[model samples]
Target: MLNTNNVDCCARVRHGPSVAGLQQALGNGAMSNSISDIENSKCLLVLATTAPTPIPSSPAG
Candidate 1:
């Protein structure tokens, strides 16, 4: 059976572990003691490595 009128016919999936990890990473300071300690610390240092991508656009017809 199929329905042609449904724009949302495609299925979407979310990975459980990945979602949990993301939630932990972005969670508030109350979620962990370490985060709260860091928040209360007088001096803080942050290091990060990022890979950036160029802007994308449709090609000329």
Candidate 2:
């Protein structure tokens, strides 16, 4: 059920000034976090070349 209206937009606008200002000051956005490169992906494949060994390494002399 979707309502085509300006629902909650005013409240969001009223509360978003500081957030918007900070984003604007920070050059639009930080873009520091990781995002999914694939859109609507059916499956993801992760390949690890090296597996961790059960043995621990000794300290160097």
- CA lDDT of 16 in candidate 1? 48
lDDT of each: 0.49, 0.49
Q: Give the TM-score of candidate 1.
A: 0.25
Model number with the top TM-score: 1
lDDT (tens digit, per residue) of candidate 2 on 1-50: 17765333332443367567658887553443345644456676758533
C-alpha positional error of residue 12 in candidate 1 after TM-score superposition, expressed in Å: 7.1
- 1-61 per-residue lDDT for model 1 (tens digits): 2866544311123234655665788763223447779879999675552327332233224
Model 2 misplacement above 4 A: 1-6, 10-12, 29-61
Give the Cα-based TM-score of candidate 2 against the true structure: 0.22
For candidate 1, what is the total of clashing residue pairs? 0
The regions of model 1 sitting more than 4 angstroms off are 4-14, 28-61
